[model samples]
Target: MILVTGATGQLGTAVLDNLLQHTPAQQVAALVRDEAKAATWQAQGVSIRVGHYGDPASLDRAMQGIEKVLLISGGGEDDALQQHYHVIDAAKKAGVRCLAYTSRALKDPSSLANHLMVRHFQTEEYLQASGLPHIIFRNILYMDTLPLFTGPTVLETGISLPGGQGRVAYALRSEMGEAIAKVLLAGTCDNRIYHFTGAEAYSFTDVAAALTELSGRQVAYTDVENEVLAGRMRERGVPEVAIERTIGFMTDIKHGQEDIVSSDLATALGRQPASLVEGVKLLYKL
Candidate 1:
């Protein structure tokens, strides 16, 4: 049985779509916070288990009868770290053979240039130490950060975060999903770590140009100080840590820390990861 946590989420849903193409529904289990949210998934024959990272009991309940489990991370919450560890513990208790987790690219200890990286590094470390068979997909920054460019708010307001034209090899979450499907099918491969990125690198200028071309609007990239960006986010009610971490991701672009393309996803799924322009056109109808 394959138990997929966060089954109702964007990534989770996409993973399920790919999984179903190659596997049977009886072998799949979906864990969601609201069982009601999975009504559509249930009707289609997925076993829906109601659960949440906040509650260990919920996770424990959902893991029952599960063989492989996908532990997708949740948005930043006070208990984010604990929640992740909880899932690992629960998976252990359920005696799942393989545990697949979604993680960030660049597992370097000093990669905290962003908040997500810090959490991802910690989560990856915890999973490895758990003595469980694990498969981790260290996905690169998502292209969906496109909203930071293509949307009316950023364009209309002329607000650009401080990437300083740094290049990022951003992959589409769909590609991540497709690669994850392959991993799930491949089962647990004894402490496997896959570093997945886009097939090419793109700069912030590339993003700005794409938005300008697609929307026929004037969008300029402005270099704001990281602290200023964090301040703005905090004023808008974002937690301090979240702002600090998110602003730090800008450094990945500025320093070209995220500029390399990799063939990992292609080798894994027998196809190339989507290109930046292709993704923009498909998503924005440009």
Candidate 2:
């Protein structure tokens, strides 16, 4: 059976949704911290395995009888890297045939986002050294995060950030999940790395134009200094740590570290992935 961790989260749930379309639910198992939260999946005939990345014994039990596993990155918490190590060890101990990990797309090692991505890089290195056949999906920034980054008042406030004119090949999270599910269903132990990115790169200015078309408003983009944006965020009660992370991502974008475009996602889905306008409409409910 194939097992998926973090099954209740958006990406994991999407993977299961697509997986069940072409495979029997009995052949899939979901790993979650709370079985109560997975009642719906359990009702749908998927085996629910209670586990957590921080707890190796639970993970070992969860991996039992599972031929392939997808290890979704843990949500940012203290000791997150250690948590991933625990999961990798458990998967190895259980002799899983193949393990897939969702990681971020390539970025410059000296980029500002390095602090945020260090764990992913470390995990990739560790996974490679484990001697287990694996698939590494280097996913780009999700189009789903546009809403959070732009904020609710972006239409009114215009697109003001420190991202400059840098472009990002943003893929929809659901589509990424779909692609991942396809690979899992193929059951290959190819030990390959896939860069899951959109076919086209788009800048914040492109986002502004897309919003203008969808919302019928004259939305505009303004590239401000990092400090200026940080000041605005601070005034709005944004936490210091959050402000730092936001600035780091924007700085990386400004440096063109996130502008890489690739067709890996489309190849996996057997079609071109959604465009910026399409993603905007779906995300903004336009």
- Backbone clashes for every candidate come to 2, 0
Measured on C-alpha atoms, candidate 1 has an lDDT of: 0.80
Q: Estimated TM-score per prediction? A: 0.88, 0.97
Ten contiguous residues with the weakest lDDT in model 1: 148-157
Q: For model 1, which pairs clash? A: 115-245, 166-253
Per residue, candidate 2 scores C-alpha lDDT tens digits across 21-80 of 999999999999999999988999999999899988899999999999899998768799
lDDT of 2 at 160: 90
Pairs of residues clashing in candidate 2: none
List per-prediction Cα lDDT, in the order shown: 0.80, 0.91
How far in Å is the alpha carbon of 231 misplaced in model 1? 6.4
**Model 1: per-residue Cα lDDT at residue 272:** 82
The TM-score of predicted model 1 comes to 0.88
Q: Candidate 1: where is the Cα deviation over 4 Å?
A: 149-159, 212-220, 227-242
